[model samples]
Target: MADRLRSIAFAIFFYGLSVPIVLGTPVAALLGTSFMRGYCIAWARLGVWSARHILGIRMRVEGQRAAGPALYPAKHQAMLETMAIAAMLDAPAIVMKRELARIPLWGWAARRYGVIVVDRAANARALRQMMREAQAALGEGRSVLIFPEGTRVAPGETPPVRSGFAGLYRALALPVVPIALDSGQVWPRRGPKRPGTVTFRFGAPIAPGLARADIEARVHAGINALEP
Candidate 1:
């Protein structure tokens, strides 16, 4: 109970303090995209820092991040990985839902930070748009991080990989690096915080050009390998 309260308090404090800076992202973007990236990294690290001190949750990143341009398909088991991945990757641009891009200050910041937004319900046009944006981000030397499950699930559950991930992989023709973690065991989808170390393990990059089935199978296997 006390841990939960502390987590809540820290969230409130973080968001409250971030509003002004997030709202200012547009101005920062005018100077350079690096400015916005720096701002985002700082905010994400703050969350990680607070989670450690206040919630007593530690993070351990195993294996080195793959070099060069690649698409990162990570398991989505909790909300913590979003910020954790952002802080860990180099100039990462996340692919998030379009609706989230309308959330006032956060939306503004996301745009400034060069994050790509996709309309899940839209037709072929939306897919093309997302591909274009993602390709552009990759061209800029930013790793594109996407969650193939499309939504959070329980730690042991394995949902089918969304078609969008396959589409992006085929279009970009970049290596796909699967990231696995067990954040749900600590910062569960719903419940009090549990104190423990969340491990983020980055698997080897699977080169492109393989059949979609092979890629998906590899991704699923890689992401599910969270424990020894």
Candidate 2:
């Protein structure tokens, strides 16, 4: 009962503060990518702060943090990691679906902030466009973050990495850093979030140029490392 109450209060506090920031997204876009990225990062940090204080959730990152241009394929479990990564990484370019990119003012800001939008239905054409944008982001010294599973999975689920990940790996020609986390244990896809520590475990980086099967196998194991 207490946890439920805390979750409700956290939601109210967080979203209430988020209104003005969401409204300012387009204006931030006009200031250029740097300012927009910072604005987004600040909002992410705000989420982290509220989660810690109001919801009693904390984050712990284990293993080496990647520096420079690399591919970070993370486990998709909940919305927490999405905000957490933005707060943690150094201006990462997150790969999100076109549906999200189609959102009103938020979508405009995301595009201007340089998020790599993937159109799953477009197949090859979409893959090509994603690679082009990813390469451009790397050139700007930003790491690309993607959830290979494509969508959030409940705890204990082991879904195969989507085909697009390997294609992006081959196109980017960068080492892959797999991030495993069990956020769903607390911040589940549905239901009230519980108070607990969410751990993100970064596995060893796999060198680029591995065969599709090999890279996919390694990443599949890496991102599920934290799973019981």
Candidate 3:
């Protein structure tokens, strides 16, 4: 119960901070400058700090950052990583579901600040389109972030890694930076939240020249080492 309260309080606090970030991005954009991008990332990192200090959730990051301007393929455990890393890493252009673009203010805020939406329901067509968009962004020197698992897993359950991500690796041929986490235990799907420790294992970058299978293997191996 106490952890749930803490979670609620922290959520409220971050929501309070997010309002300013949403407003600031546009205000800055109106000022005829690109300052909002940095502000957006700064606000994201602050939100991450609040998750730790305010909510008592801790994150442990491992491995070295090898994918600068590369594809960041992560093991999806919860929404926390989605938000937290959006701040911790460089102003990487995000690839998320197209549905989010319909969210009230959040969609606008994220889109204006470099969020790229991929329609998950489009099946093979979605794959074809997303690659084109992702490649264009990466070519412009942006890092790509993707959840190879495709969907969130229940706590303690392992899901088959969808081939979409592997397909992405083969196509991009960019170094893969794998980030793993144990967040589901502390964060309930539809119930109260707990203040458990989560770890982000960042495997070394799969160098640009490595074989695609070898690179994907290394990424999966790193995630396998993480605790549930």
Candidate 4:
């Protein structure tokens, strides 16, 4: 209960500060393109920093940054991992849930950073939009991250990635890098949260030949193989 209160308090505080930060993104974009990448991910760094300092969570990252930008297919245990990676990765482009864009500060800031948002229920339009935005981001030499599971999974539960993921891979034709972690066990997905180490291990990039039918299965196996 103490841990939960701390985590919740930190989250609410972060959200409170985020109101003005969201509107300032447009101003940052207009300042210069150099400010663009940093502007996109700065709030993420704040959230991650607060997680570590205020809530006492630590993060470990594996795998080196390769030459070309690739797509990250990560397991969604808790939302903290995404914010942590936002600060850690080199100018990463995010593919996120469409509803997030509707939030007061986060949504506007995310769009300014070129984070792709998709309405999972609107299959065709959403996939097309995600691919289009992803291609543009890759062309600009940025990495894109997506959660194939499409939603959060509780500890010990399996995340069955939707077919929408395979379609995104096939359409984008970009390298898919799988990130496996046991973050949910530490963060506990908003229930009985505890401060501890959450490790993020990056697996090898999936080759182009990895077919659609096999993509989700491959990602699932990789995430399951991580430490429990």
After TM-score superposition, what is the CA distance of residue 224 in candidate 4 from its true location, in Å? 2.9
Backbone N/Cα/C clashes per model: 0, 0, 0, 0
Scored against the true structure, residue 44 in model 4 reaches a CA lDDT of 78
TM-score for every candidate vs. truth? Answer: 0.93, 0.97, 0.84, 0.88
Model 3, span 24-137: residue lDDT tens: 666866653247677777777887788888777888777766635788877676778887777667777787778887888778877777666777666887788878877877
Tens digits of per-residue lDDT for model 2, 1-228: 998899899889999989899999878888978998999999888998998999899999999766667899999898889889877786699999999999998888788888999987767777888989999998998999999998899999999999999989998999899999999998976778999999999889899999999999999999999989
Count backbone overlaps in model 4: 0
Full ranking by TM-score: 2, 1, 4, 3
What lDDT score is found at residue 122 in candidate 2? 62
TM-score of 1: 0.93
Q: Give the winner by lDDT: 2 or 3.
A: 2
For model 1, the local distance difference test gives 0.85
Compose the digit string of candidate 4's lDDT tens values, residues 89-203: 7668888888988887667767777888888686676678888988888788888888888888876777678777787787777777788877787777546657888888888
lDDT, candidate 1, 119-163, per-residue tens: 878689899999999989988988999988888888889888888
**Once superposed on the true structure, which residue ranges of model 1 sit more than 4 Å away at CA?**
none
lDDT per model vs. reference: 0.85, 0.90, 0.73, 0.77
